[model samples]
Target: MSTKRKHEVPDQQEPKRKHVEEPDQQGFTRKNAEVPDLQELKKKQTEVPGQQEPVREKVLDHIYGNKFWGPYLSERQWCTVREETLGNCWDSTSYEKITHDSYRWGEDGIFGLSDEQQKLCMGLTLWNGKDSVVKERFFGLTGPQGNLGEDVKELYFYLDNDPDHRYMKALYLYPQTEFPYTDLIEQNKEGFCHSAGKGVFDDGHWQIIVEYTKPESDTILCRYTVTNISTGVQTLNLSPKFWFRHDHDAKHMTDVSCFQVKGDESVVSVSYQLEPDCCYATYKLEVKPGGEDIIEWELLPVGKPSYIDNSSDVIQEWKIKAETFYNSLYDCQWSDQEKAVAKGAWAGLLWNKQFYYYDVDELYHRGQAVENKVKTVKPGNWDVMERNIKWRKHFKAKDILSVPDKWEFPWFAAWDTCFQMIPFCRLDPDFAKHQLLLLLSERYMSPEGQLPGCEFNFDDNNPPIHAWTSLKVFQMTGETDLNFLFNSYCKLQKNYNWWMTNLQCSDKYIFYGGFLGLDNISVVDRGCPPEGYSIKQADATAWMALFALSMVQIGIELTRHNFPSPGDIQKDLIKYLKDFLCISHQLNKDIDNGGMWNLEMTFYNDVLVDQLTEQYIPIQVRSLVGLLPLVACGIVNFSGIRCTEELKQALQTDSIHVCDITCGTVNFSGIGCTEELKQAFQTDSIHVCGVIKVRSLVGLLPLVACGTVNFSGIGCTEELKQAFQTDSIHVCGVIKVRLLVALLPLVACSTVNFSGIGGTE
Candidate 1:
C-alpha cells in the first residue's frame, strides 16, 4: 500500500457505485455521460485539426511514479542498505545457520552474499513533491528466480566445493569511505531498542536508523519519525512490499482516481484486484470550502456489507471484491457497488485522477521502511518516467562513489542489450542517448572503446559489441553528442589497435590470444598451434570487423553533433578491419593451416597430433565467438541505415572474408553438451538448437541481433513474451523497443538509451 500527496485539493461528488462512467480518449470522463469500455479507452486516437491533445498509449500518456521514492514527502531516503555480514558464508560454521530466505536477517543480503561487509548496499531517493529524481537503478539479481539472496542463504553460498561462484556481492568496502558497526555484538545497546523513552526511544513506531553520506559523495541522507507506537530494536532483517497506491485508510488501503480537469460534473470508475487481508470502502476526498475535511461529497456503497472481506465473505475468507463487498465498505442507503458498475461510475475525482498507495509499515511496526523506500524503486513507472524525459537534468554516475540501490556500474550485455532497446527509444530519447553514453561514457569504458564485460569485475573481457550499441543509439535517437561518441571512437581505435598490436603473430590478430570467453562462447577459449600448442586467441578480430562497420555509422552521427569530418576515425576503422581480416584469414585457416582445434584437450601438435583436422575446431559453445562479425549488418544498417559515406568506408569488408570463412559451418555446444568428432567427420544435418541445449537461445543471441536468425530461432513462438517483458528501465528494455520502434523512434529510443545504462542509476 502507499500514501497520498500531502495537499488536499478542491473536491467533487464521488460518482455513485451503481453507475460507473467511461473515461474519454484522454483518460478522462465526458461531462456526465455513460463511461466507455476499457478496450475503447485504450484505442489509438486520431489527432484533430490543430489540436495538441496526446494520443492514447503514447509515452506522454504515461506518468511515471516510482514505487519506492513515492513514499517521501519532504526528505530523501536510501533505497538499499548493507554492512551486515561477511562475504564468506560457506565456511562450515556459517553454512549451517543460513537458509534460502536468509535475507530476512543477514547483512547486505540483498544479493545473498553472507560475508564481506563494508559498504551499505543502500541508496536514497527524493520525489520533491513534484515527480522524480532518478539517476539510475541497479538490480542485484543472481540464481534462479533472479534472486542471489535466497541462493546464498539457503544454498550456503555454494562455495564449499566451487570457488568460482564465490565472486559476487553488493559491497566490497573500498577504503575511500569507512564507517563501523558493533562487532558480533553480544549485548544490546539500550537506545537501539525502541521504547517510550525520554529522548531517542518513542512509543509511536520501531525505527531502522541508517546513514548513507560518506562526506565525499552525493549519497542518501535521511531521518526517521514513524507515526506508530510500541517501539522495536533492530531485528535481524525485514522484507516488505512497498509500491505507491491510493490507500486513504491508515489501517488497510484504499484507491482513488484524479486527473487535471478545469470545471466539470462527471463520473469516474476504478477497477482493482482485492486480495487477502485487503479491506476497502469509499470516501469523498473533499477540500474544505474554507478549511475543513468536507467541502464536497458523494456516496454509493449504500449500506454495510455482508462482512469485512474485500471479497465480502467475512465469514469464510478475509478479502473484498470491488463488486462483492462494496456495500460493507460503505454504509449508504442510496447507492451500491454493483449499481456503480452497472452504469459505469466510480468513486474518484471527476476529471483528473491519480492513485495513492498507503504504507502499512508506517501504520503498523514492520519491515525495511527506510531502505526499501529508498533502494528498490521500479523504473518507467509514474514517478521517474517523467523525469527520464529530461536528459541533462538526469543524473550521470561518472564518479566511483555510490549508495546501494544506486547504479554504480552499468553491467550491459555484449550485443543483445544494445539492439533490445529499440522500442524504449520512443519514451525518452535523452535517456536512450544516455544509455549509449553510460556504456561508452568516460566511466566504465576502458581507454579502448570496449565497455567492461560486466560492471563489478572489469578485469577485461566480455563480448566485443559496444560499437554496435553506440551506432544504434545515435541512429535511433537522432541526437548527436560529438564529444561523447568521438572520444568513444578514439578509445575504440585504441582498443582495436591493442588487438592488432598484441594479438598479431604475423599479420592481423586472429586466433592468437585467449578470449575472456563469457560462458564459454569460443572453441577452446584459445587458439591452438598446428604442431599443437594452446594459444591465447584474439577472437576480437572478427568483432573488430563488425565494430569497423558500426564505427562508420557512429562517425556520421559525430558530424551531426558538430564535429570535424569523421575522416580520421573512419580511416582507422577501415584500416583496422583490413588488418584484422587479412591476418585472420591466414591464421584461422582450415585444419590444413595447422591450427589446434581444442584449448584444454591437447597442448600442441607434438602432444596430440592425431586429432587435428580440416574442420574440427574442437567446437565448444564458446565457438559462437565467430558469429560476432555478423553484427556489422545492423550497426552500419547495410540496407542503407547508416549516416555517412566516410564512415561506411571504414567498415569496408571486401578486403577480408572474415564473416564468410568463419561462419561457413560448425556445430557448437556448451562444454560437454556435444561430442567433438574428428575433422574427417562431416555432416550438413547437425541440429543447432538441440546441440546447444538452450533452444537456440544462448547460441543464437548474436545471430538474431544481426538479422541472421537460424531456421530454429527464426520460428516465432511465445518465447518472445519472456524476451519482451524484461524491465525496460532496469534491463535492456528489449520488449519496449520491439513494440515502439515502428511508431515513434524518438520517444522509445530513451528506453534503448536507459537500457544501455543497465539500471545503474
Candidate 2:
C-alpha cells in the first residue's frame, strides 16, 4: 500500500534501490533513508554563498570603515511634481490635476522634501562602461511627476529562492542592536554622502552590512557583507536590486541602448549609453560563505575611455583611499566623535560647492532690465545703458571656488572667501591658495581692478582684504615661495589704486556703501547714498589704511626675497607706509576737528551731510566704526631709515587720538589706558588705549597693531602688559569660533615663535 501528499518541492529523481511500504495518513511505515551528519551539514553550509566562516583572532592595526546614524522614514511616501509642471496636466478639472495644483511646495508643505531634492536637482555625469565617453543625465525615482520625483525608495536585499520569499529592508540601527553603534558615514573631507546601513535577514537571522564608496575613478562601489548568526545550517541565494529613473525621452531612448554583459559565473555586468552620458553597472557575487560582494557603477561620456581595464583593482583602490584618509585623522588628538564630525563638515563643504560656467544669457537679460530701470530714473545718465551692456559683455564665468554655504547664499563674497581660506589651508593648502588667487583672476575681477563683492552684483565693492589674507597664508605656511606673493602684490596694487581713485570721498577719506560686508551696522544704509550728501565712513578709511599697510608689508617681504629688486620694492614700501601714516594722521585730525567725533561723548560716529549746504553732521553710533582705526595700526621697526618729523608726529599723535567707543551702550567708562599708554599720550608717543568690553575681533585689533611697537625705546607699561595678557586669553578662547579672528593673531603678531610646530619649515 502507498500514500501520497504535497511536498515542499517536487522531487526530481528518486534515489536508486530505495523501496519501502507506505501507509495512509493515519499509519506509519519503515523505509531506508539517508540522514547527513550535523557536522557535515554545517561544513556544507560553510561552502554556500553569502555565509560567514568562523572567525580566527588576529591583530587589528588599521580601521578603514565607519558607521553613522541612519535616517528613519515614518511611512513610505511619494514625491510631488514641481510647480512649473502644473501646465502639463491635460484635464484641468481632474482629481490628479487639482491635487497637483493645490499641493504646496517647501519644507512645511504636506509633502515635505529632503536635502536630496536640492542635491539631485542638478544633473550628474556618468562614464560609459564601454568607453571613455562621459555623459550628463538627470536621474530620479519613478513617479507621476513628469521628469523628477520627490522621494527615493530604499534599496532591499532578498534570497533568490525561498518559499515565503521574505525580503530584508534597510533601516537605522539603534542601541538595541548587537553591533557597535558608530555615527560615521564614510566621505571625503568635503562632505559627500556615500552609502551606509546595517540590517538583518528575517529567515536566517544573518547580519547585512552595506557601504557605498567612490574612489578616484568614475565608478561607485556598493559593497555588502552578509554573515550568518544562527547556529543551524543556513543557505541563501542572495539577490540585490538597484532601481533608478533616468531622463530618457523618446528621442533619448532612440539614441541610446542598454544591455547586459556576461562575465564569470559569479559576475554580471550591465552597460548603457544615453548619448553624451554612458553608464555601466557591474555586479560581483562571492561563491563561498562569509565573503563579500560588490556592485560597481560607472558613468562617463560615450567615447573611447582613457583607461578602464582593472575594474576590481579600482574597487580595492577606493578602499585603500578611505583607509588612508581615516589614518590621517586618526593621529590627531581629537576624539573619534570629534574627528567624525570634522570629517562630515569638511566633506559637506566640498560636496556642496558646484563647479560650472556662469549663465551668460540670464545675466545679460537681467543687466538689460536693470539698465532700462536706471535710465528711467536718471535720464541725464544716458550712457548708463551702454555701461551696463559693456559690463554684461565683460562678465564671463569660469570654473571658480564656490562658497561653502551654497543653500542660503550661492554667490561668492570676496571677504568671505578670505576668511574661508584659513581652515581650508589646514585641510588642503593648495586648494586654499588657489581660492585666494581665484578672486583676483581676470574672469572674476574687473579690469578696473574692482574685486567683486559677490557673484550677483559684480560692480559692488567689498572690503579690500585680499592682500591681508594673502600675507596671512604666507606667514602661516612660512613659505618663501615668492611666486604667489609677487602675483598677489601686482593684483593688490591695482586694487589699491582703484580704491584710492574711485572710492575716495575726500583727499584722505574713503567712501563706501553698506556693501562693505557689514550690513545693518552702519548708521546710513550702505547700499544707498543719503540724498545730496556724500558720506565718509570711518570703517572705509580704516580698511584703506589697513590695505595700504598690507601693501607696505608685502613690499617689505618682496624686498627680503630680492626678486623685484630691493630698491624698487623698498621705494614702493616706503610710499605705501607714508600713505598709511598720512591716512592715519588725517583720520586723527578729523576726530580732533570734531568731524565725526563727539568731543564731550569721546566717541567716533559716521558723518552724513547736506550736499547743497556743504555741511556735515555725525550719525552718532558707537560700533565697530570707532574701533576700526586700531586695525590700521601697523608697527614699524624703524631701525635703519630716518623717520620724518611729520611721520613721527603723526604716529605719536594718532596713538592717543581716541574715538570714544563702547562695545555698545554699556560704557567701559574711560579708555582703559595703562600707565604706559597714559604717559605716551601725555608725552605724545605711540601707545594704545584699552577698555573692558565683550571680547571681539575688532576689540583685539589694537593688540595686533602693537606688534610693531618700539617697546625698547618707549618702555612697556604694566597696564599694557596686563591688557595684552587679558586680550590674548580672550582671543585664544574665541580662536575656534571665527576663522578670521583665529588667523588674525597668527598673521598680525610678528613675534610668534613657531619653531617647534610641524610644517613651519
Candidate 3:
C-alpha cells in the first residue's frame, strides 16, 4: 500500500485535509443504501465529484456551521452568513420585494411599511381546530422551481404569543453542492404525531415540520404523521392529508424558531399570540412508537406557499428554463452543484467584519441573550419587542455562530462572514469555503469593487479587511486559489479607495464619524463611535492607515498575476496622512514645513457640543490624537520636510510628549518602557472623572507605542493587550482607544518611517 492512506486524496486531487465537524462530510448513512446500492461496513467511501476531501470544517463551526444544543435542526449547521431583508417591514405595499439597497438597523428606522399593504402585512391567526391544534402554514416554493435552493435541515421554533416569544426568521438557503444534510430528515412519519386539541408551554397544542418536499415526487415525499396523545394508536391509523399545491398557495410569514425537543415527548401544545404581528406557523413531525409498520402523515399548516399577488402577474411571469435561468433565483436547484455555485454569486459582502464580534456583546444588557429566534406573522407584532428589551438571538445555543448577517436577510456583509468562517471551519470546511465563495460571488461584490458592508447595502464602505482575512484563511489552510482570491483583492481595493475618498472629510485623513456613520458624531456619542467615526477623526485617521496597509499587502499578492493596477485610485492616500501628522501634531511635535501639531489631553471626557457651538472649545493637546501619527503605516507617501527630526525625536524616551483630553486636560498613547510618550501615560496625577475610575486612556497606551498595523500587533504592549484580551473593559473611550490602539503598532512599531507609512515613496 502507498505510504499515504489509500483513501487519502492525491495532491492533484486536493489539499491537506483538516477533519472538521460537518457530519455530512463523513456521514454516508444507511440512507445511501436506500438511495443507491452502495454500502460500506468496514469504512467504505463514496466520492461526490466537486466535494473536497472530507476535511472537518474548523472555522465554520463557530458561526454558520453551529452545533445546536439538543437535537440540532440538521447536519448542515447555521453558519454565519450575510443577507438583507427582502423589503422594509412587510406591512408596506412592496412587501414581496426586498429592499433594493442595503441598510443598517437603527440607522434609518425600518418603519417604511405603512398601514396599506395589508395583504403582505396581515396579522397571523392560529386557527385552532376542534382538536385544539392551532395551525398556520408557509410554502417556501411552489414546486421544484419554487424551492429557492433551500437545503433545509433544522427548524427555528419560537413562541410568538408573548413578548418573550420573539420573532427572528431569516434564511441563507445554502447550496447542497458544498455541504448538504439531505439525509437528516426522517424518511417516514415513523410512529405517531401529537394529538389535536392539546397545547404546549402554557396550555397550548401545536407542532410543525412536515415530511414532504413536493407532492408529485415519487419519494413518497410529503408525508404528515400525527398521533393525538389520547388517541395514539387510533390517530396513527389516519392517512396524511396534505393539500395539493395547485389547490391553495401561501407563504408563511416567519414566526417561530425551534431546534429540537428534549425527548420528542408530547407535553407541548403549540399556541399563538393574537397580536397584529405575532409570528404564526403550523408544521408536521415524525414519531415512531412500539408498533408501527410504516411512517404516516399528521396535521400541518393550513396553507403552503399558496398566496401570490393575484393583483399583479409579475411573479407568474418569472419562469425557469435552463437557457433562461441565470441571474434570477426562481429556477435555481439545490442539488445541481453547478447552479448552486453560480446562484450563490454574492458580491464580496461581509468582509470588513470577519475578525469582529469574536467577543463583542452577544449578551443583552437585560442579562439575557441579545439574539432571538423569530417566527413570522402579522406586521405589528414585530414592534412589540423593538423596545430596549435586548434578547439573545438563536444563532445556535446563544453561543454566537460566526458573526451576524447584518442588514436584514437579503444581503449580508463580507468581513462578518470571515469572523463567521473561523468557527464554521470546524463544522464543514466545504461549507466554510462556500461561505467565502458566496461572498466573492458577483452579487455580494459591488460594481465599484466594494464588498457589502456590515449592513445590507452593498454600496456602503465599512471596514477594509477582506483581502487580509482571505490571506489569513489561506495561511490556515494552503488552499490557495489565487484566481478567485485575487478577484476579492481587487474588490477590496475599491472599498479602500472609497473609504479614503468618500468618507474622508479633512484635507488631512480621518474617516466617517458619528453614531450611525454621520459626521461630527463624537466618539463618546455612544461610548464607541457606534456606526463609525469621521475620516478626519483621530481614531478614524488611524483606521484609514491600517486599512491602506491591508490593501497594500493584499494588493501585492494579487500583483504577482499582473492584476490591473487600481490606478491612482488610492494614490492620494499619503497626501492627507502626511499633512495630518505634520499639521495635527498628534504626537505634539512642532517645527518645519508649517506643521500644526496639537498637544495631548490628560483625561477622557466628551468634547461638549456646547463648547464648540459657543466657540469656547478646549484645544488641549491629548494623547488620543497625539498617537494618531502611529496610524500612518503603509499608506502615506511622505514628501518634503513634512516629517522633521523634531517629530521623530518626540516618539522616544528623551522627551515627555503629552496626549490626553479628559476634563479639558491632554493625555497620551503609545508609551514605551522609557519613551517620551511613556511619561504622559504613566503620570498618576492626571485627574480623570467618571463612575469607572481606571482611566481607559492610560491602559491603552501600548497600542500607540508599539505601532504596528498588523491585526496581531494591535495593542502590542502587555497592558493594552490585557485590556483587550481580558475583556470586560467597560470604558466609553475603550472601543475608539482600542481601535486607535489597534492601528498604532502597525505604524509605531513598523519597519517603515512614519512619513512613508501609507506607501509614500
Among these predictions, the greatest TM-score belongs to 2
Best prediction by lDDT: 2
Residues 1-761, model 3: lDDT tens digits:
00011112123232222211111211111111111111231133234343322321221232112111111011111121211122233222121222122111111111100011111111112232232222121212111211222222222222111000011111111111111112222211232212110122122222322221111111111222232222222211112211100100013213321111111344422332212211122221222222222222111111222212120131122212211433343344455776545333221121111211211122121121112213221122222323212112221111112334221222234555676565444333444655675555544454444445543233444445555466656545554656555655555656566565666543334344322222323334422432333113444544555555555444444433334443232232233224333323332222111112322332211222232232212223344443544534432112222323333343333232323311122212111123323333455644322111223334556666432234343435656655655353422323323345232222322222222212111
Q: Rate the local accuracy (lDDT) of all candidates.
A: 0.29, 0.41, 0.29
Ten-residue region with minimum lDDT total, candidate 1: 745-754
Q: After superposing candidate 2, which stretches have Cα over 4 Å from the reference?
A: 1-296, 299-341, 359-390, 521-523, 589-596, 633-761
Model 1 per-residue lDDT tens digits across residues 20-61: 222332122223222222334334343344333344323222
The C-alpha RMSD of each candidate to the native structure, in angstroms, is 24.2, 20.8, 22.4
Instruction: Single out the weakest 10-residue window by summed lDDT for candidate 2.
Output: 56-65
Candidate 2 lDDT score at position 634: 47
Which portions of model 3 show Cα errors greater than 4 Å?
1-90, 93-411, 425-446, 454-461, 513-539, 556-761
- State the displacement of the C-alpha of residue 398, model 3, in Å, after optimal TM-score superposition: 29
After aligning candidate 3 to the native by TM-score, how far in Å is the CA of 173 from where it should be?
A: 22
